[model samples]
Target: MINDEDERFNSELDEWRKLPVFKQALVILHLVEHIIEGIHLDDPHPSTHYKLRLYERYTRQMMENALLIPSEIATADSTDLYDHKMENATIIRKAAKEIIADSKGLQASGYKEAEYLELLYDAVEEFRPLFAEWVQSFSTKNFIIDRWGLFNPPGVSYDDPVDTMSFDSKSFLRDLEDDWDDGDDDDLI
Candidate 1:
């Protein structure tokens, strides 16, 4: 059976696919594919092969990061979701940087063509502004008071008092057990 989460995931996938930023990411992925396709995976030298492998791994990670963006946006609106999306963006940025670095390494090692590296770099450069715009579109409102201090909006602090009481799972479970042990449970059925 298709459950709620599956439905939500499909919906979010559709939404993100239509986004210009996501489309730009896909173009980058296509460039990565071409770059990978041009690599000679059967290089005789082990170190050269390893460097090529690293380049492929970083490019694959970039693709995965792009795929994760939709799910990050699909998370329930809260400070937690904002934090998660920010974290994803950070990862994407790091991966893109790594890809460029690794491309240079591959070129220096004579394992990759300058043309492919330049193409990949150009694609990532094009993707950057779209990525920035997408990040700017995230809503900072609809967030709960972030108790950890890290994800809270500016002007909010972890030490700030809130009206809602914290939930006590142990106390709730104890009361539930007590109710189950009592004879009144018969009426609940």
Candidate 2:
């Protein structure tokens, strides 16, 4: 049977792939892959090892974060879509920053040259404006009040009173029962 999470992921993946920010994220991934191809840790120096490890970790994170963006986008429910989107945007931006920083670390250690790493940096630089535009498009209307100090929409705070709404368990169960009752008996057989 098809599950809701899978269905949501599939739908969001298609829409996300069409987004310019998503496309640029793919480009950054590609550049990361290409750059890593030339990175080597054969040197015996411990600092070189550390720098190479940091570069590897950040690049891997970039790939993982890019893949996670769609799932994060799909996780929106009745009250937290904006938070998820903002969180994912922060993830993307942090990945870009880490990639650039670690690449410089590698350059300082002579594992990779700044000139060659410039391409990867440039791709991430290009992704920034696209990411900003995508973030600006998120609406505050769909959000729940964030109790944590983080991820709240602008001018909102953790100290603000929680929303007074409460879930009606009886009504929710009634709806679920109605859905089950409406199912064709033949489907169970």
Q: In terms of lDDT, which candidate is strongest?
A: 2
The reply for model 1, stretches above 4 Å from the true place, is 1-13, 41-80, 144-150, 162-189
lDDT of 2 at 142: 54
Please list the C-alpha lDDT of all candidates, in the order they appear. Answer: 0.62, 0.65
1-189 in candidate 1: lDDT tens per residue?
Answer: 236657986786576567776677677667666766776666587786667677666656645654544344333222234545565666666666666676676566565478877887887788788878877776654344557666555566767766432434466799989967877545545
Which candidate has the highest TM-score of all? 2
Each model's TM-score, in the order given? 0.62, 0.69
Instruction: Look at candidate 2 and give me any clashing residue pairs.
Output: none
Candidate 2 vs. true structure, TM-score: 0.69
Question: Residue-wise lDDT of candidate 2 within 1-189, one digit each (tens)?
Answer: 336656986886576557787777777767666667766677698786777677677556655654554444333222335766677667666767877776676566555456667887787788788778877888865555557768777877767765521334466799989967875645556
Q: Which regions of candidate 2 are displaced past 4 Å?
A: 1-12, 40-80, 164-189
Candidate 2: deviation at residue 5, Å?
13
Q: Can you give the lDDT of residue 8 in candidate 1?
A: 84
